[model samples]
Target: MARMFRVLGFFTLVIALMSFAGDLTEMSLLFFVQTVVFFLLGYLNFTEKTYILLFWAYMVLSFLGFTYWTVFRMGLPF
Candidate 1:
């Protein structure tokens, strides 16, 4: 069960990264939602603290990338 969540989290992370290739609005929304889902899965299913920490790192990085693309690249005030 825990292993399944880890695998799902990895796949979700990959999909979230791939979403960067799409429209900025869509990418932000998709990545944000995916990150939240991954975090939830990690918190609930991961026994090891390392997995949870890794998910948090990935989520923070994903948010930073989204912010950069939306604010700097796209010239949005957000």
Candidate 2:
């Protein structure tokens, strides 16, 4: 799933660049952060830790970042 997230984030980042409707710079930044989060998630997911606290943190950050930037910044009903 983390790999999937990185792939999707990269895809969206490219879309944002080509579309040129939304704030491409901001979109690209958010997607980049998301890609990092996904990479971390992949690492943590594969680890043998007793708790996935970092996983939750990554989830929250990625969710809120994507939503805030996309919805209120670049996407519909902003």
Candidate 3:
């Protein structure tokens, strides 16, 4: 179980890093990954607040990464 969890963590990290480098084509994939992170954290036996905190932190990081990718790749800002 521990080994499986470690492997999954490694996989997620890779995905997250790729997500930082993706364009709009991968936005949905990034969202899916964010959803999975929430799902896994939600299943924890800890407090609900912990889940909320982790989710928000993850969102902040994801938003910054995606925003950076979009702004640089799309060059859409006026």
Top candidate by TM-score: 3
User: Over the stretch 1-78, how does candidate 2's per-residue lDDT look in tens digits?
Assistant: 445545655675576565456756766666666556555555554543422555566669779977898888796962
Which regions in candidate 1 have their CA more than 4 angstroms from the true location?
Answer: 1-47
What do the candidate models score in CA lDDT, each in turn? 0.68, 0.61, 0.61
Residue pairs of candidate 1 with colliding backbone atoms = none
> How good is model 3 by TM-score?
0.48
lDDT tens digits by residue: candidate 1, 1-78? 456555676776677667765656675567568666665765565567766676578669979997898888899555
Give the candidates in order of TM-score, highest first: 3, 1, 2
Estimated TM-score for each candidate? 0.45, 0.39, 0.48
Better of 1 and 3 by lDDT: 1
Scored against the true structure, residue 52 in model 3 reaches a CA lDDT of 57
RMSD of 1: 7.7
TM-score of 2: 0.39
How accurate locally is residue 21 in candidate 1, as Cα lDDT from 0 to 100?
55
